[model samples]
Target: MLELNDISYMAGNRTILQGISFNVRKGELLMVSGPSGSGKSTLLRIIGDQLSPASGSIRLNGRSILEYRPEEYRQKVSYVFQTPTLFMDTVIEDLEFPYRIRSAAPDMERIRELLPEVGLTEEILQKESRVISGGEKQRVALLRSLLIAPDILLLDEVTASLDRENARMIENTVKCLSARGMTIIWVTHDPDQLELSDRVLRIRDGKVVESIA
Candidate 1:
């Protein structure tokens, strides 16, 4: 399980997160909901190790997240942003990113299997990322994040910008991944998406006020 204990993050005089705590069990889908500036995304960033908390600690299993190697820690827990950022020009380029980052060879067969799962055809591999719809790009980003077999996924409003069909596609993908034992921590304001969660946490002023299971 991924555990957060009394986690507090401060920016100069302002405290962004205060005594924030939770546990994300293996294969569980945890949805964090809040209004803007409630620090949902910031919490995700802390889990992803993008930001450091002023106090407290985060542990995956029994180990401290801060003790792991930077690259290896990132490989173990992947973060997917709300906005898609494609590195290479083509769809294949985006798909091949994680492998490049880890200096691993691209798995063509795995990539082929993932395309249809994300509602993309094999032909999409050849298309330029710049030409694809925003929804398609979001799926591409998701598949890319999973390429490295991350044990945990941190998503920040990942489906917020997609249409109904695309949003459903992404939600289904997340469900499948969690079913297969990938821990998920997602931040969103949509109640519909929260319906898919195993647990729901309501955040206010950077603190968890309610936890519904």
Candidate 2:
């Protein structure tokens, strides 16, 4: 479980999040829904430990995330952005990048199986990541993030750039993962995403106004 207590953030003179508090249960899909600039992305970043809250405590699994080693904590909690960012040239390289970073053995067979599950064919594995469509890249990014089997997944408008077909493909994979008990926290303005969530949090000016669970 992840818990945020009286979390607040400030940038220069402006306050972004004010006493934000929430608890995300294990295996629950928590959807943060609100207009742009409502601090959804910031909240995710805070939870992911990319950004620190000015005042508050963020606890993961009954302990503060700050107490864990950075790499170990990151492996347990993965964050995916709106756009697919790849470091390597090819699709396969990008998928295998995480394990490489951690010096872990590459599970080739598992990766190959995941590729098809994410709607990518074997032929495209050798191709440059830049050549793939935005949707394919996003799927690849997601696979890369899941290489270490993160306990918590934080996604920011993951399907915002994909077409309906591609979006659904990603959605299906996400739903399948959620069904298998992954902790998914996503930020979106899409009603469909809200409808699919186990819990919905509505934000206004960085404060949670209502929770539809």
Assess every candidate by TM-score.
0.97, 0.97
Model 2, CA-based lDDT? 0.90
lDDT of 1 by residue, 1-213 (tens): 899999999888998899998898899999999889988999999999999999999998789997899998999999999999998999998898788877889998999988777778898899999999999999899889888888999889998998888899999888888788788999997899988899999999999999999
What are the runs in model 2 whose C-alpha is more than 4 Å off? none
Worst 10 residues of 1 by lDDT: 112-121
lDDT values for all models: 0.90, 0.90
Residue 66 CA displacement from its true place in model 2, Å? 1.0
After superposition, which runs of candidate 1 have C-alpha atoms over 4 Å from their true positions?
Answer: none
Query: What are the per-residue Cα lDDT tens digits for candidate 2 across 8-75?
Result: 99999999999999999999999999888989999999999899999999999999988999998999
Error of 2 at 158 (Å): 0.6
TM-score of 2: 0.97
lDDT of 1: 0.90
